[model samples]
Target: MSSFDLTEDQQDCLQELINVAMGQASDQLARYLDTFVYLKVPSIEQVKSEHLFETLNQDLKATAVVSQGFFGYEGIRGEALLMYQPQDSHRLADLLGYEADELTFDEQIIDLSSILTTTFLNVFASQIDNQMSYSAPRLLSANQGTISEHLNQQSFNWDLALKVRISYQVTDYSFNCDMVLLIPEEAINNIKAVIDRILEDF
Candidate 1:
């Protein structure tokens, strides 16, 4: 039996896998917006549940909302989240050719948002899964308030967190999206075990 802590190589692999996933996410966004999308590598930061708001505030000055859930293979599960400043949502909707103010919580927008979120999760998860040789990914959406709501939670198991941020410029409008990864503490041990097995075999 091996200790749960991840080896240095495992950490590097996780980061590399996340980078690939984020790159795929950015490409998908570019295709959807029909314009180049500027992206930054996801970062891992230690944050206190109480200070979540402050942390989110540092990256964005407006009301920050988040949508989160877990997705991945049978055992090698991965968590996912989408967060952004509330104001950015309006610009993002507009980039998709939607009038933010005109659109209400109608099923159409809700359904569309679900679809968009699913696509983003799928693309990102698929890339990471490929790199790790994991099973197909699964996606879940939070029915909470907004993006900020879930992210601000006092506690959520995320032993490994990766955040991919995007800033888009379409015409005069600016769009922002943050793709976050959250893995439960248990999964950290599982992932480390998987890495150890691989290392032993080689």
Candidate 2:
């Protein structure tokens, strides 16, 4: 097994926790949007920092990115990133009961991003029984860079990433959202320690 690789049993337990968080987020979104929200079988990967784009997600792009960092005395620290199509900002605004005019577009994107990120992020931390706190979410537009690039710029040398993707369909339009938790190379041991505890509880 590689440094970032998880045993089959660990992967199973992690996927279950991820599924719960994703399902809860979907339910909240369904009620918020008044539309059906669907989740596919979630996945977790131990991807190298360099191969982030190719090995992890082929559709990764330079678009809307919202992220928050989590940490506490519990030694749990990681970043949550959400990426979506910039074009969907307008539709999202309308869904949230606002028009996406020039003046409101930025605020609309930020608000939508915050709602989606916080909902599931909190769930992930709680399900792990780790008292993690999150910093205010940060948003990057298309001009800033791809999400991977942004992570690199943040001086984050993530050796592995745990990615979960969920989709939402509203009538004729369909949207795909990618959410990931990136772990630094040095933090891998610390994280797997937590995962071990989670597995023991299972």
lDDT of 2 at 42: 59
**Position 134, candidate 2: lDDT:** 74
Report lDDT (Cα) of residue 139, candidate 1.
26
lDDT of 2 by residue, 69-126 (tens): 7774456677766677665544766676665574365566667667766776677777
Give the alpha-carbon lDDT of every model. Answer: 0.50, 0.65
Candidate 1: the clashing residue pairs are 65-147, 65-148, 66-147, 66-148
User: How far in Å is the alpha carbon of 16 misplaced in model 2?
Assistant: 0.6
lDDT of 1 by residue, 102-189 (tens): 6652322343344445555576556544222222232232233443454444465443332333332333456555555545556666
Residue pairs in candidate 2 whose N, alpha carbon or C atoms collide under 3 angstroms: none
Top of the candidates by TM-score = 2
